[model samples]
Target chain A: MKARLRNFLVALLALAGHLALTSPAAAATADPLPSWREGPARQAIVKFVQTATDRASAGFVPPAERIATFDNDGTLWTEHPMYTQLAFALDRIRELAPQHPEWKTQQPFKAVLDNDLEALAAGGEKGLLELVMASHAGMSTAEFEALVSDWFKKARHPRFKKPYTELTFQPMLELLAYLRSNGFKTYIVSGGGIEFMRPMTEAVYGIPPEQVIGSSIKTRYEMQEGKPVLTRLPEINFIDDKTGKPIGINTFIGRRPVAAFGNSDGDREMLEWTGAGKGARLMMLVLHDDAEREYAYGPANGLPDTKFGTFSQSTMDEAKQKGWIVISMKNDWQRVFSFQPETMNPAKK
Target chain B: MKARLRNFLVALLALAGHLALTSPAAAATADPLPSWREGPARQAIVKFVQTATDRASAGFVPPAERIATFDNDGTLWTEHPMYTQLAFALDRIRELAPQHPEWKTQQPFKAVLDNDLEALAAGGEKGLLELVMASHAGMSTAEFEALVSDWFKKARHPRFKKPYTELTFQPMLELLAYLRSNGFKTYIVSGGGIEFMRPMTEAVYGIPPEQVIGSSIKTRYEMQEGKPVLTRLPEINFIDDKTGKPIGINTFIGRRPVAAFGNSDGDREMLEWTGAGKGARLMMLVLHDDAEREYAYGPANGLPDTKFGTFSQSTMDEAKQKGWIVISMKNDWQRVFSFQPETMNPAKK
Candidate 1:
């Protein structure tokens, strides 16, 4: 009897949340996504959300099953002056250099301290792992979170000259809001450290800590002065990238996503897993074609490629072959960040 | 521009969900938890929810942070005679005995096949891991879920003569609903396998699969006939018991819970982690003192201890010292299960 009542109660709450977005006062506007220009990419997203939420439509999905995942790096914010996490690590190395004199001579540490990007890139994943272990662990979760928040207070994006939090794509923020209004739970499925992202996600993306799934290090529970603390351990627990992206999604969220968006090869598996679900799915890859506005380096346009967020030719080919929508930044978005002057979407103003 | 709008939109939706439970028609009832008898235990819960949700009160917690976690085996359902998972494992061994004739001679398998509970008890944790690996892995996640569903269809609790799902505590179910009605997001953080619990959590407890966190085995994503499937491997990825409880909560939920409930020492860290957080917190343990209504085995009140869900004397003492509520099943609950006749909660009558 309680279970039945509980289900009814939950359904009512879900319905209330759903109604908040679909109500006339909220979504009655002619253009739900004003920043999205008139293009197939914009049309695909708008159409999918409409069809999926319409109870009379065959594509209608239950409110509880309306889960959508977004890749964090280049997809949601800037990852191109280097992946934001990599930049954080390099800055951390410099911050701690005075305390550790030996780091000046250490191979990877020396490269970072010397500001030699070429030498640091040459050290590859091994070097990056070393930097992450040094910078991201060996403290209580509370302390780590405090450190991250402190860093974010002063850390400015090298290219945009704006705070990292401010660099989040304004159009994407609108989509997240639109999805939530329609009862879709938006989650950040990222390769970045989970701890690193949780501190700012709620402020920047409106995604609270629990909805973020990403790479993690092991944490241990210890008693300090008769108080419990979860201490971070410098061991890799799970990596949420490439094939790991799908695994992370499946493990963290037991439901398959109805919509997924990403920008690079690292997100191909996530898009594949989401598209494989039986329904009207919206799978999109953001193409960084507008170097004039944002960073663009991918094999898709014969641009110079970097190890960070690689958009390979094969992944581009697969997106076409599998019928996934490719979002062209230069054409589809009226404006990338809200700070910029509105490009004025052709369909609007 | 969109960020401010998104915040307003999200706040509106959150308010809508909150009002669903607090509405006159829903919360107008005199007692939200009817199965809870008159006592300090019941009073404490009522007071906590009232204060926590009261915006004018200092104890008020935001809806997003109103996360509650519950332990599955003992707290939510009966765990005596042996855990439900243990029963499943032993039954699985018997089901596969025809194919693996070697099991007719193997140690733990022989013990299970021979119907010798004493020998199986003597094998301990190592032997149990072997049984779990043998039965729970070497199949796709989808296949494992189907197997779990099939088992639930026929498997009955030995003492109750009802399905395991039907054995959940009525008062606890009421508590779960009461919390949700007040805008709390309840989660199951159990020592049981994640896949094993997810198949039935939504139906039995009104908790969805994504909200359930538990022990897991390694899973690798692979392409099977051009379709993606996650294959469960025969290696333990995590064990969500003992100190592991806090780690699992932190790793998956990323927020310390405002409330936590459990029945054994395995949940000590989780409770401690929760209580350590600032705010009005409710940490509770279920004491099964009603031998007539359900199985009672613990160190408390001279009850015989068992390997499954052990309630240690030290943990009982610590609960008192820490001011965590210890709920006596005999004294507090009006009825154990929904199918039972109402004992007529003293205050209600």
Candidate 2:
């Protein structure tokens, strides 16, 4: 009887030790999306990845065909107060104001100089293009890359006060890593300038330059002082937004993505294109509904409509009709940015 | 004494078995470029790859930055008897001739139908664009891919009497595989239409569609019968030749290539741009000097210059001055094509 009791006790201890070793690892594997709250949005992503990766599943996608595209601006990071690229352009104009004394009297340049965003907005697309050309062009690609890199090193967001790179969504970053781990190639199909995004994409999003498709201005190859240089020109080459999104994806990737994530009306066509593919696919839109953590400006719940990343009612309707997942920032995420608010040291105004 | 002899025999047998198993594997690793004969061209390639991959070497490049670009036509495959794409276009025009009655009288169309090369050359770039649009555009990207794939399956070269896809350079194919084995990404940066090359690149060159950078026509995205389709437009979007080569590389790849290979003046800017980068770089030009195996039409050795892939005297001079390795087809290649002449079964005339 004593031998039986001792054996039972030993078996119990062995079982406990095995559980201890495997529990954490099992938990990690089970909940790949820890930042995502237990909701429909997270469930859909998990299910799609599971089905696509399972060899026996009807929706099994080969690794080569497992392409996932994400929009950059509001989907990946903060595009509030203004677009990060626009902010860069404004700052660039200010930096060059000293070079052109006429900028002190010029309408759009003066508006930017005085921090008058309303007037700058009133100047419209033409005014914005002028600012982009003046700031983004006239330098070799190498020089422009350095200039953008230097700016990113010092620039801080107006509201969050964090460096722009730090403002990337923690949940999205986790999602990117998770997808990549599951043999899905993640690409950034953004409306931002290709050169502007290529410099920092690898470091920030773990996405290489070749995987990024974005807007671009023309660049010319020439021999300057017996050395080859790619000089950036002021003319616009391609805009990767709205209808252009699908076209750009076809042009660059030459493959239809199985899944797509975006935050605005600009992403509607891309999502539709992805959903139209004949397979189990995922389409997600991140709704900015948390006023405390991030700016809320979607056309949802009487939120003010903003031009930065316009999430229109029609887009919401389309998502509903197509059964696309609408990810609520307030209800779905356990965290927003990577760093805690207290840790962010805002630059002096 | 009998036991001792048995032991010695077992040991000798074990040594012989081990040598037999490892010999082929060791040879494969030692000589990555088996098709490339012992010459400066092969030496340059072997040296560059070794230095770039060696972690202890000063010229060590990370796996991500080891990008190698190659021109498609004359460099990777035969461009003589006109470009492969041009032949495909002519066949397509003939196939569609029965449908269009007006084409029977059209100048370029008549020239194509009658097999008049002189008249087709007189029609020039504008006429080529017309043929391309008629044959390549108006169809969906998927449909175009199927068309090209079907054509490649049946089409045969006039001189080689083999399928055009089978005419790919054996040495370059070996080079591509070697580069890929050493952690380098091989990309086809060609002047051919992006769509035309994509179908065959993967099957013939082991390059996926996304890695191909080439000329393109404008495509529009639209929902037809509730399904999204990208329709190729009858307009030129961008060209990928000469100065355009560098631009295309920048636009699609967003990274400067560490190594570049080409066969004509059209590749001058791409090689120059690649060589201008910091650290060790390699630029090579394939000089077509073998008349028996491949047509010789360069300015070298008093050969007749053809418009297809013109290697002018100035280009040769520049290549010499820049220290770009010139590969002589006759001397540097042990084999030209994957298939021997005896195996080819030409299509019915």
Candidate 3:
């Protein structure tokens, strides 16, 4: 009886193995919109995307017309305290300072080297522009690209201590992918220099260099030793900020985006332009609110000395009145930066 | 006896059905490379491509790094008598002549409108450059893009009377596809304006706008009513001709192509650059030698007015010695142009 039982068990096991081998195990998992924290804003966005993508839905748009524009600095990634490009430019200054003796005694450069946040902050746009121009200009586009690639490899953020690219919001990456899968041709329409963003945009954002519309510097072609060269000029060619965003988009793309995203008043025109378009349009603004997970300070909500600041409530009120999607970072996102792994343990102390 | 007869009839019918299904008589006829005449040159290309692409062979390079650069104008399509862009610019002059009254009285414009090929050609480089600059510049990038899209729709080639894009070489298109299948990133490094090439590259060559590197005009960014505008300047920018070809390729792509193809000495530098690179480089030149089948041309054999005339026997010898693949149009190509159907039949009547 024991021998019979053993033989029966072996036969069953063989049958199970045969069934498993013959089964269609390579079936792809269905990719749905990732579950966002349940809320009215999330619901509206989900509904819009679903309706627009659905063939049977009344709000359905043709795949060819499904263009979406996204702001990179704040909407797609964390831009707290200051824009990431500023951070990159600042780090570049430090790396380059040793080569130039004058910078050791320079006002802004000295402030940057000394880590005097107050003095650097006081420098404002004029100071920042000088810092950027000194560090970013002069290199050939190819040289600049290599420099950026090198910087990305070594530099880490002051607070997060993680690579700047790693600080990109996980939820936003999912949204970009979701939008793409739904037949949207996503673009980065921002105030960033076109060349500066072109180097890393493809790897980090999946947006090609050509699709990135931004501010640009004047370039001239000159024949040096019978070979043509593209030289970058220090002159300001275009400033893609505030109201300039919409016009830049219109001029470059020749068509209006069906959806737009932004985090500050700088992107107000882009959102306004998208919302003004006919038929289906979706616009969203990311409001920073989590103090523990992320630094939070709106014009009305933060401590006087806090570095983080937000747009006036009037802008949020305007967004609400316009039926725009205002995402509350604290309430909507399941997680912030995707690079942070799920579990963290202190090294055996 | 009846049962035996019925069984015999069933067997005979079954045999007939099996033969009908299995035999070539019931199968579709295969397509031959119809345009290609039987020749040793054609045989060599076909055999080499087949051997290289075969997975069983030792020489299997992945498609991503299979960079193939082709010269525009003559190599891929017909640019005989006059370059295609020149024709477009002349037509543009005529279109804009009414708007600019001065053009009607002008030498080049008058010649263009009057259909005097002699007078138009008389203008040479000075007049041609001026005409091109006037017709091509002063518009926003968007306006120029729209103009191209519109012009392509209506303009017909003077010789073929078909759309210029339709005049592309059919065999080359097949070769491009075959190369792509085997892992090649094809690019058109042309002497044409970058903006001019971009509007139609995707539709005509299947090359994305960003992949095309060519001559360009300086553009400036201006804030017009709060929007950034990229204004095309009248000043000459990069001239991607002669030695500039290789330099442009290096600047834009940051790597040397493995394979390069051209039809003229304008492509000499490009071919040289490709050959100079280490390891398994393939450089081919399309020698136009079939006047009967297409247009006959060589620095020694055809068209005196051609920019570099044609390839000389001594030049051909040097190319051969350098291990370059010289594709004789008369021998290698199956078809000269994609519009052969129209050429073959003037009318159904």
TM-score of each: 0.92, 0.90, 0.70
Q: Which residue window of length 10 is worst by lDDT in model 2 chain B?
A: B340-349
- Model 1: lDDT to the true structure: 0.88
Query: RMSD in angstroms, candidate 2?
Result: 8.9
Regions of candidate 2 where Cα sits further than 4 Å from its true position: A1-30, A341-349, B1-30, B341-349
The candidates' interface RMSDs, in order, read 10.4, 16.2, 18.1
lDDT of 1 at B156: 97
> Could you give candidate 3's per-residue lDDT for residues B1-349 as a string of tens digits?
2445445544544555555556565555443345444565456555655655567766554444467888887777877667778878988888888888877678878888888988877988787888888888888767888888788888887767888778787767766666675677788888877777777877788876656777776665454685544577787766887777876675455456777888777777787777665545677778877665456766644445355335666667667777777777766665678656523421121
Arranged by TM-score, best first? 1, 2, 3
How many backbone clashes can be found in candidate 2? 0
DockQ of each: 0.36, 0.27, 0.08
Chain B TM-score in each of the candidates: 0.91, 0.89, 0.81
RMSD of 3: 10.6
Q: List the residue pairs that clash in candidate 3.
A: A237-B221, A238-B221, A244-B226, A244-B227, B35-B334, B36-B334, B63-B183, B298-B310, B299-B310, B299-B311
> What ranking emerges by lDDT with the best candidate at the front?
2, 1, 3
Q: Over 4 Å off in model 1, which ranges?
A: A1-30, A344-349, B1-28, B344-349
Query: What is the DockQ (computed on Cα atoms) for candidate 2?
Result: 0.27
What's the TM for model 1? 0.92
Of the true contacts between chains A and B, what fraction does model 3 have? 0.00
